[model samples]
Target: MEFFFYAVPSLMIAGFAAAAYLLVRRARRLRRTWTHGLTAEARCLRMFTTAGGGGGDTSVHTTVHHVYEFTTREGRTVRFEEENGPTTVLEGDFVTVRYLPELPQRATALPPTPGRLAVGTGVGLVFLGIAGSFCVGFILLVHVIFAESDGLLP
Candidate 1:
């Protein structure tokens, strides 16, 4: 019982911290790639749907995958897939592709809408908030536990 009293909160704190880290890292990468990437005309090669889901307590979902290919100014052909793209796009349609010149393979099929960046940032901030709450809760828990042991908390 004592072990669980401390372990549960510790696990929650760790999980939230890890989630916040991953969210922030992804948000930063997406923002950087879109902001600094070079542009080229890419053609939609094909489209497919993939089954994706978060496990345990999360719901399962399907993702529409868009495969696009573009040729670099250096004549190198690069192909990439994106799950979040406008639904009106079809095979053979030309779209704007953004990529780092040095890493053309990591190109984006479509530019994010104005709200996309804000949404990513907002989600990351929420995760950070949850992590902060857990940290503060854990610290207070520890202080209360120790204070009770010393008869300072009654």
Candidate 2:
């Protein structure tokens, strides 16, 4: 019980911190790629759908996957599957793609929308909020447990 109060929060804090670090690293890498990457019009080849709902016409949750094809500056063609969650860009649609010039295979059909910085900050705040809530709840639980054990609470 004693270990539960302390160890759980410690693990949660560590996990959240690690997650935040990874998120920041990824955002930085993405920003660098976007800033120095080349752009091309990528054509959607096909879309695959995975349905995850079964309620006899009541639940209709589905995920759409897209495969895009684009050409590099060196006249080589590349095809990639994009993991766009719940958002479907129509097959045969021409979308702007960003790729590292030297490594054209590292490409994204979904360029970070215009306000990328703002979006990153917003996501960070949401994660922070979640972590903060867990920390606060754990602290309160610890305080209540200690207080009751000492007969401080009626």
Candidate 3:
């Protein structure tokens, strides 16, 4: 029981930290690739919106998805579809895309956005808040238990 109290909280903290680390790592990598990679104009072939997550609520949040195609430096063409957040890219619009020279498939139509960073930070904060609550509860419980055992509490 004592081991569980410490081990569970430790595991939860580690899990949250690892998730945040991965999110930050991926965002950094995407930003670096966008900054250093080759850029080209891609034509958006189609655009669509899909409702995400929410159901039974009148206000359903939707995400815009766009399909784009661009010709690489080597004369090869590549097509990719990605979520464009709230901004909608119209079909036939020539949007800028950045891609690696060696792996053209690793590309993004937009630079690294702040949404991922914000989400990671929010998750970490929420985890910390929960862990802090657990810690406070544990400390209070230990104090009460010890006081009662010693007959210090009337």
Candidate 4:
């Protein structure tokens, strides 16, 4: 009981922190890739969509992904896939590619948009809410279990 009292809440808080850190790091990486990365023209090789988790009355979601290839300034050809693309993009269409100088394969077909970043932000918020509620519930349960006869409620 004592271990559960402390460990679970600590884990929950740590999870919340990790999620926030990941989202922020992604935003920063996208910003840097847009500002400092080299650009080349890439031809979309394929486009596909996979349905997200769904069952038992849960609504299904889908994500679009694309694979493209471009040659770097050094003449090395690289292929990469990205999940976020405009709806108008189609296989065989040419799109702008941004890639890191040192790692030509690290590329994105589209720059980070406010809408894409907002989706990550929203996901982080939902995770925070879940972890926060768990921690709050833990505190209340501990208080009730260890409360004196004086009664916190009274």
Candidate 5:
């Protein structure tokens, strides 16, 4: 029973660590791909409206229309849809996009900013660390609580 108690929490912590590592790794790879600049082409498809709350703390709801599109570049095509904001590209206009080479399907019209990427990655890793820690702590707490309640712990 003692061994199981230790083993279960250990496994939980290990699993959380692995998941957090994977997320950070993926974010880093994406950041790198953004830096290198992958080829992409974009064109606006249409526009649609969506509702959102307004500013001034008045909580006024309003509908806004934004452009949508089908973009193709580097042998991959994706719908470049935007909502509630004006896109730089217009309908029937061809535009270039940059993306991670590994994930050609995920393209962005904007250029990569290394500073922003670094900040984003750092923040993401921090958040992941916090989340993982919370998960591990929760798992251990639950196990200990249950064990004590059941008189399983000597």
Candidate 6:
């Protein structure tokens, strides 16, 4: 019973850790593909701000609006808006964008600094933490059920 408790939690933690590792790896691959393959030109159109409150906390967020213009190899011009933080980008600046070769509207503006990588890391960690919590809960439940069956409950 004791061994089951330890083993189940350990396995759960390991599983979450593995998932986090895989997610980070995938994000890295996506970053590489965006950096090397897709190419487009865009201009920062404006900056926008919005505020919202929920539960008990209020917060405001800023987004830099941008318009990307590019021509497909088939000779069709495409344009779209992209929202990002103004701190990392500015208005009236020409920015490089990467889009899906087939879906020009789906794109991202590459940050000048590698700071975006840090953001990606933070996001990955958040996802890992949530998954880890669920896994740990499940393991605890399993341990409790099995221990009870073995008359080990106290």
**Candidate 3 CA-lDDT value:** 0.75
- Write candidate 1's Cα lDDT for 58-96 as tens digits: 888877889999998889999888886877898899999
Ranking by TM-score: 4, 1, 2, 3, 6, 5
Q: Tens digit of lDDT per residue, candidate 6, span 12-104?
A: 789879888887875665576476556767676655554445445656544455555666566777777765545556667777777667666
Better of 2 and 6 by lDDT: 2
* Clashes (N, CA, C under 3 Å) per candidate: 0, 0, 0, 0, 0, 0
Give the best candidate by lDDT: 4
Instruction: For model 4, name the residue pairs that clash.
Output: none
Q: How large an RMSD does model 2 have?
A: 4.6
Worst-scoring 10-residue span by lDDT in model 2: 80-89
**Model 1, which residues run further than 4 Å from truth?**
1-8, 51-60, 135-139, 142-154
Q: What ranges in model 2 sit over 4 Å off?
A: 51-62, 74-77, 85-88, 136-154
lDDT of 5 at 51: 55
Off by over 4 Å in 4: 112-130, 133-144, 147-154
lDDT ranking from best candidate downward: 4, 1, 2, 3, 6, 5
lDDT, model 3, position 95:
83
Which candidate should be chosen as best, given TM-score against the real structure? 4
**lDDT per model, in order?**
0.79, 0.76, 0.75, 0.81, 0.61, 0.68
Candidate 6 lDDT trough over 10 residues, lowest sum: 47-56
TM-score of 4: 0.78
* Model 3 ranges with Cα > 4 A deviation: 1-11, 55-59, 85-88, 111-154
Query: Residue 28, candidate 4: how far off, in angstroms?
Result: 0.2
Q: Write the per-residue lDDT of candidate 5 for residues 17-89, one digit (tens) a residue.
A: 7877877786676576677855655665665556566667867665544333444444445664434334454
